[model samples]
Target: MSGEERGKRAARNEDLFRQVNERLHDLAVISGSSEPHGKFVCECEQTSCSLLVELSAGEYGAVRANDTRFLVFPEPWHTSPEVEAVVERHDRYWVVEKRGTAGAEAEDLAERGSNLL
Candidate 1:
């Protein structure tokens, strides 16, 4: 696939993962789970990735503060340098901000209400 196509695909995959995490958060709220941390799937470009990262609600909220930002594992393989940059790094997870075409795509998805909680 072309570079732009690859970026778009990555954005879509990450957005989907973000949606899942949003649902998980909503469930936590509904269930009144006072747990300090939640398990969220890694928002990486790799389709086969099933790595889960644990984060506090505040930490996840920080990552979701930006439409183009995503939560991923801190490992290097979890990041796509071609389409994103690591904006924040924590002990358990890294926040990646999509750039260029991928960023536009992520913003578009967010605007479409895909992140509704």
Candidate 2:
């Protein structure tokens, strides 16, 4: 293909990647048992309800979000009284928020992982 065509193809690929990312963010991680990490299953406040998605270290173990984009503010940030108040009220969230790079790594690990655990 011509150089112009190649550049256009790369641009198209970037655009496609962005679109796919947008769609991925739209999804909620399903909650269940934490086998490899731990035996206990996460029981967010919504357990009594129909929601099954757990509070995982999404985005490692800093700010948490559940099945519906419902967010959990993990530590460091959790040090703040505001975050602490939420935790005190909810009393279910275990893990605290991780740093940005770690969060991205956790996401990658989850993507590479399986449910066999």
Candidate 3:
């Protein structure tokens, strides 16, 4: 795949992971506890990556403020230059933004809750 294709794929994968976390958040809210922090799957480009990252509800909300920003483990193995840019690094995770066409697509999916490609 070309760099552009890889970037789009990465964005789609991360969005899917984010949806799963959002569902969990909704469930927590319904249950009344609504835990402030929880472990969520790393919203990275690598589909095989099963690593989980911890985030507070506020931190997650901050990431959701921009559809391109994703939470990824701050490890060397998680790097993907063609797909995303590491915008911020925290103790447990790094904030990555999808680039190029991928970013546009991610923003679209975030708004529509559906896939375009």
Candidate 4:
């Protein structure tokens, strides 16, 4: 695939991860309480990875505050160069934000009605 295609794919993968987290958050809300911390699958571009990162409700909220920001395993960006930067790093996970066209696509995904988390 071309570089553009790879970028698009990376952005879409991030959106998919965001959707999963949104659903998890909704479930937590309905259950009346969130655990002190919960495990969420790493939302990186690595298809072979099944790693789960632990995050507190507040931590997840911070990541959700930005449409382009995604929670990923540290160094996933090394393999997925489409990611533009590492905006934040926590003990368990890293926050990556897309750039250029990929960033725009992620923002668009956030605006969708289904993305209301």
lDDT of each: 0.91, 0.30, 0.81, 0.76
Candidate maximizing lDDT:
1
lDDT of 1 by residue, 8-104 (tens): 8899888889999998888987898888998899999999999999999888898899999999989999999999999999998989999999999
* Model 2 lDDT tens row, 53-73: 223334212332321112322
Off by over 4 Å in 4: 76-79, 113-117
How many angstroms is residue 94 displaced in model 1 relative to the true structure, after the best TM-score fit? 0.6
Best by TM-score: 1
Which candidate do you rate higher for lDDT, 3 or 4? 3
Candidate RMSDs in Å, in order, are 1.9, 15.9, 2.4, 2.7
TM of each candidate vs. truth: 0.94, 0.24, 0.87, 0.84
Report the C-alpha displacement of residue 79, candidate 3, in angstroms.
3.0
Candidate 3 TM-score versus the reference: 0.87
Across 1-117, the per-residue lDDT of candidate 4 in tens digits comes to: 877777778777777877887777777767877477777778887777767787888899999899888888766543355446888877889988888878887887778744533
Candidate 2: worst 10 consecutive residues by lDDT?
A: 38-47
Ranking by lDDT: 1, 3, 4, 2
Cα deviation of 69 in candidate 2 (Å)? 11
Return the lDDT, model 2, position 100. Answer: 36
Q: List the residue pairs that clash in candidate 3.
A: none
Shift of residue 65 alpha carbon in model 1, Å = 1.2
